[model samples]
Target: MASTTPQGLCIHPRQMDFELPDPLPRHWHGGDAFKSHLFDAMSLQFPDGERFFIDSVRYFREHIGDPQLRKQIRSFIGQEGHHSREHQVYSKRLRDLGYDIDRLEGHVQARIRFTQKRLSPQRQLAATAALEHITAIMAEGLLRDARHLEGAHPTMVRLWRWHALEETEHKAVAFDVYNQVCGNRSLLRRAMLMGTFFFVLDTSRGLVHMLKRDGLLWNWRVWRGGLSWLWGKRGIYRPLLGPYRDFFRDDFHPWQRDSLELLQRLRGEFDGAHQAEEANGPVPS
Candidate 1:
């Protein structure tokens, strides 16, 4: 665990410079119909979500008085903005494909209202930290499990891969921000909020949206496959939970361990593959 002092919290700005590769898969153009519907529902509540993050940074800047932390928050906001833009494009393609983006977004907005009216700021921040942690873990898992995705839809894999890379880059930002804002808060409270919010709201919404789009909500195969993916050796949830526990431990620093090494290896593999393809010249179509 790294110390939480201002001096110990610095993150390089260059870490956020990576870009998505060109010629992305076509299937990803229309979105993962299932996930898009779910995301549409989720995005409805935070209509100006990119602005919400920017506002949060403003709040932190006025109250926190930490320049480094503020810079990190801004970088996180920028990364999130990029994500929002890309996802919006993907969702639009889904709408063009005949999915009900408006209806789904409306339902998600209603859910966000319920959560905002019910939860306190402390609880909300805790939930944000937990969700960010999960995202970071899943990002790593996707990079690790690239093989499972290789022969599937290239568009889906490319979208997820680009997402995973960004997630890894900003993994520490939200948690660091939450800790700075809520000094000396109990870890138990954070853990409780994470479990409650994720299982009750996030997972429920995702499952419902997945079912609505795929018509596999009642299908055993979908259930089995989803559960297996979630709980299996390469699953995101299991490995992520361990880090969640570490997050509560006394000495945790985002930079303490070299978790980004896996990311480096994945990048190397991608670069090598491109080079090999170039060496092979044009293949017969």
Candidate 2:
């Protein structure tokens, strides 16, 4: 369902089998429980979270007037739809390993339910726009930083690389939709501020839950490594703070942060030959 756009962007989905065929190691990231669990904890949030993203965008899909963005909506939906399904299978891997993935997913799902029920349509779209910004930046970090996936299982690495690539491809769709339909700047900014807070809180809660379950809650090694991985010399989170704050700028848009070569490289590395050959313009090799 993925195709090239007029601008030469590959706007389609790459459907891959993210299967955990073996008994997965509890700590898959370079054998560090904290590092592995950090990403796995984040995985717990994706299935339902991505669904909410799809729904928020879908809610506004029919109303979009631009043909290019309208087409982009379909591609965005396709990409996210694949991400949700793949991550569902991916989450089950952690669930099978006794990480209590379902419990956290339930809490997150309930939170999404509350947002859907209580927030205005514009507010919901604004939230989606804000959260998409978070994911896009996070994806950028993962793609740009080799250490994020280094020492991880091959399957996991490929899966995440694929996700990062597609997230880059479609990062602007929801924001564009929000911009077209909603003109209230404060709603967008306010939602972004709250979204960042909750995103970190929820991710931490899930990671801590897994740590306690794995009986590594007090492990100083994991504590040290996890802190270092996120905040150390080559830490992923520190570099993102500036980009994260960029969301508050009034003229900000996803394209303002360019990483086109990153997109090309990841797609070339992970995409099947067929998918790659079909990419038009600047999106494919």
Each model's total of backbone clashes = 5, 1
Show the lowest summed lDDT stretch of 10 residues, model 1: 276-285
The residue-level lDDT of candidate 1 at 24 comes to 31
TM-score of 2: 0.92
Write the residue-wise lDDT of candidate 1 on 1-285 in tens digits.
Answer: 243433433222222222333333323324333333333344332333433444344455555566666566665666666666666665555556554666655554554465557865555555556556655665776677653354545555565576676667667666677677774447535654654464346445644654656566677765565566557776545766776566566666554545556655555433455432221122111
lDDT for position 114 in model 1: 58
Q: Tell me the lDDT of model 1 at 148.
A: 32
Q: Mark the regions of model 1 whose C-alpha exceeds 4 Å error after superposition.
A: 1-54, 111-123, 191-200, 233-236, 265-285
Q: Tell me the lDDT of candidate 1.
A: 0.52
Worst 10 residues of 2 by lDDT: 276-285
What is the Cα root-mean-square deviation between model 1 and the actual structure? 8.5
Each model's lDDT comes to 0.52, 0.82
Candidate 1 lands at a TM-score of 0.67
Identify the runs in model 2 with alpha carbons over 4 angstroms from their true place.
1-6, 277-285
